[model samples]
Target: MIGNYLEFNVFFDIIGTIAFAISGAILGCKKKMDILGVIVLGLVTALGGGFVRDLVLGINPPNMFQNSTNAIISTVFSVLVFMFFYFRKNFTSRQVLIFMNEFMILSDTIGLASFTITGMTTALSLGLDKKFLLIFVGSITGVGGGMIRDVLAGTIPFIFKEQIYAGACILGSIVFLLTRNFLGDQVSMIICFFTVLIFRLLAVKKNWNLPRISD
Candidate 1:
């Protein structure tokens, strides 16, 4: 059903899953998790967002679990990422840590963008009409997995910790809704996906952040 309209979306889904899986594997390694634990984190990070969204929407069984494609994809990527990190064995080096951290951030950002668009498209297809629900669903699909991954990894969630994480997702979701009337569905999704991606990248590069109260 979803595959029909999501001609190119499935591809983004695979890429996003791989990206998030790698990020999860990196975090799991940082937390000193074993291979099994790392794999669990990767799977959760890849699918947790959709799981939450489905539960909220009463989509029993969830889409990822219904078919084995995404699960298999995530698992393979997780194992490959874990092996790469294991073989490297240089986490202590400052340069190595910096490079790995940057890479993780980049992967996370890509996943966030891909998932945001996917979520909005899915919600629209589901006949969900409210703007808030669309944004909320999109945001959840974008960051829900990362939230679970961070919690399991014993660190602050990126959506909460990063400068403009969920904000970027929200903005992208809004863009999708706004452009729906004026643009084709495919074009709208692409615009929204890039909106989140480019926005997050710019925010990170420029150190843009929401204001925090005095400490």
Candidate 2:
């Protein structure tokens, strides 16, 4: 069903990988991890979601291991992030912290949006037809990496505490599934991507949050 949208899938996959890698690298910097740690964190955050998704779908070895392109991309970007901070020696530690916080949010939001669509496309391409399963897989693909990154970084997963994270992905998946037939795959994918992106950004901007028990 999604065969004709292969180009869109690949495009979003790359975008998502790069964005997630950058976000992970930034988090590493915030944690004061070494360069190697930064790269490892970035790789995990960029690929962890797909790793889980493929494993659940029974794809042995997973795409992250099957191909080296995304891995290489993640590594290069992680190193670049490290170097970027390294060379900005004039910036105070507080300044760096502030900048990283803002930039990480932007990259993570983009990654969340892009990967949500890619996850749905992957399920659709593999002939999965159930709506709930598609949304579930897509949300996993969108947020799983960040969850792993946070855990490895010794922080609570933001999706559980921060503004609408996986919820944005679920909504985007629903939008894509709803619009795909009428708008066509490419258009629907674009719409879905932006839907998640905008929703996430707005959540951050407005400090939106689901109800939780008062501490």
Q: Best candidate per TM-score, number?
A: 2
**Model 2 spans > 4 angstroms off:** none
The C-alpha RMSD in Å for every predicted model, in order, reads 1.8, 1.1
Predict model 1's lDDT versus the native. 0.85
Tens digits of lDDT, candidate 1, 1-215: 45544776777788788888888988887777899998999899999888888887888889987988888888888888778778886766788788778988999999999988777767767888788988999999999999999998888887766779999999999998898778867778788889999999999999888887767
Lowest-lDDT window of 10 residues in candidate 2? Answer: 86-95
What lDDT score belongs to each candidate, Candidate 1 first?
0.85, 0.93
**Residue 155 shift from truth in candidate 2, angstroms:** 0.6
Candidate 1, which segments miss by more than 4 Å at Cα? 1-4
Pairs that collide, model 1:
none
| Candidate 2 lDDT over residue span 45-120, tens digit each | 9999999899877778899989999999999999999889878876457877888899999999999999998888
